[model samples]
Target: MRLELSTMRRVQRNPPCDHIIRLFEWFYTEDQVILIMERPPNSVTLFEFIKHSKGHPTERAAKVIVRQIIVALHHCNVCGVHHNHTHLRNILINRDTLQLKLIDFGGARLIAETPSEERTLGAVSRETAVRSGCECLYRVLCALIKGIPFWIRLSRECTDLLQELKNDRTWNTLENILDHAWFKEASTVNRGERN
Candidate 1:
């Protein structure tokens, strides 16, 4: 099945999560397919958001943004989908609510459809596919956090984890990195605070 079709199927089956872009409906004919989605009046792509900021997101903001992205990826994994493209351009943020929405599932693939080599441990699991996606995100986040094109002058925690991500032999999952001392410590402190 087409990636969009599979994505629609998985999304519709799951309970709504604010971090995922809502697909209202779709139309298909011999020539074209149309996806009607929810778009807030004032919103911009994450790329534009970052570019306009003209500065890196703070540690606090980065944590929140990363957490939301992780949540969205988790939902996709639970529904058996993998968002192959997890970059800034495909993500949107509501200017007012500051809510994140993952869009453009054209690159998304069902976990079951992925080639065996791409799957972690040569087996399919919700965590593996989603964590694989996180590999992309980790790089981006590190770059943003350090305001550099490469992971240089980053915190010790980020540097160590980034090394793990780069090591093919390393089995560190995205969930494992998220629960690392860096992010977990932040979560513990912000548990009761509201955005």
Candidate 2:
């Protein structure tokens, strides 16, 4: 039943992550379910890139990838959805252009709204719920920038950011975070390293 629901949601939701492959069609047979999605051409996972190139990805390339991911995440959060298992492998890159698209939403969850009174320690303010989502975005970008292992990084960042969303004091919205000098500085550092 859970599988059935997941399959249905996959077809129905049309999640906004362009990096993620969208489910175009689905069917249920007597014994199983079949799902069809658009196949990316010459796709490579970020994990493969890290493995092949070792831990050092050019800072420029990393920033481009991270920026695209943040954009996608920003969109997802606006729609009240969160991908619980975002990681390097879930991001697919075009070999020619290095364009990134987030993929795989089997672990996505609809973010529940929290009451202002429920905001606890480490929690961002009610007005900053969007910023809490951005923190999640930052954690993933930071992990990639630092060359942290995908699985370990994703687990730690997701857990920590989710906690922060549930409890931070100075939380701002996603737009505010993106506008901050710190994010620009980090991105610039990454870009500089590429050169």
* Per-candidate clashes, comma-separated: 0, 10
- For candidate 1, write residues 1-195 as lDDT tens digits: 256876856866748777888888788888878788888658898778777765345555666677778778777776777877888888898765668888888877666644563565333555557567667667657645654333224445555555665663344344555666557653332222234
TM-score for predicted model 2 compared with the true structure: 0.61
Instruction: Identify the candidate with maximal lDDT.
Output: 1
Clashes of 1: 0
lDDT of 2 by residue, 88-172 (tens): 7877877667777776766665555665433442223334445445555556555555664333222333344335434643544
Models 1 onward score TM values of 0.74, 0.61
RMSD value for candidate 2: 8.0
Off by over 4 Å in 1: 54-56, 113-128, 148-160, 168-173, 185-195
Give me the runs in candidate 2 sitting further than 4 Å from their true place. Answer: 1-17, 54-56, 114-139, 146-171, 182-195
Model 2 steric clash pairs = 19-101, 19-102, 19-103, 20-102, 20-103, 122-167, 122-168, 123-167, 123-168, 124-168
